[model samples]
Target: MSRRSTRAARPAGAARPAGCPCGLPEPYDACCGRFHAGAAAPTAEALMRSRYSAFVQANAAYLLRTWHPRTRPDRLDLGPGTRWTGLEILAVRDGSAFHTTGTVTFRASFRGGSLHERSRFERVDGAWAYLDGEFPD
Candidate 1:
């Protein structure tokens, strides 16, 4: 990713307390840092936003860095006309053994078009991180 994209991605949204903007009652680090940290995300939602940031910032290191070894891709593409607008937390639940999960819904604008998605997250090593999530339109 380009430095411009990386720098642009980090500053678009308000600095959240590592918590779910969806009001899921969790901190960002506790909810999403695990996958961001190379562990497993406790849910699918957390994985989504962090991935979004990864794309916006063109954070190839972070993208490759956080991907699960089983399914990690060789490289990521930060497509043209991508911009982040805001984030919102949706729901959360406890997973098995020091693992928690959450679902987050968010809106973003790219190429002058708006998009929405529900992201998931997971917890690992007593911390949360993004796992993998699907874009549900």
Candidate 2:
């Protein structure tokens, strides 16, 4: 089996005592937690941040829900042993509340390494959703 297939889902409802895993200054409940609890993100960037937090928390349901239907994968496997450590938003463009499309460039650091990606988002049915992403060379 591939590494992705070998991955297992973390237990749902795991408690987070610290701030959100997305590197936001606010506590989880005030930040990404609200989004996880059915509250809509106000902007594409906010959705992007919450999605990052979802990955950190192994919240696969939230990830699938926030992904644009056209491009959303059938399954998301957050391959095991990966520990997301930090996030840095490098830039954002046109993902405002009034805009339909936007992009966010960020660096996500993990245990063994880091990845730099420029992600695209779009508003679907008046809610922001992840569309796609490109890795920087």
Which structure among the candidates has the greatest TM-score?
2
The pairs that clash in candidate 2 are: none
Off by over 4 Å in 1: 1-50, 92-100, 124-129
Model 2: residues >4 Å from true position, as ranges?
A: 1-18
Over 109-133, each residue of candidate 1 has an lDDT whose tens digit, in order, gives 5556766665545554554445565
Candidate 2 TM-score over all chains jointly? 0.85
lDDT of 2 by residue, 43-75 (tens): 877898899899998999999999999999999
Residue 23 displacement in candidate 1 (angstroms): 13
Error of 1 at 24 (Å): 15
Measured on C-alpha atoms, candidate 2 has an lDDT of: 0.86
Pick by lDDT: which candidate is best? 2
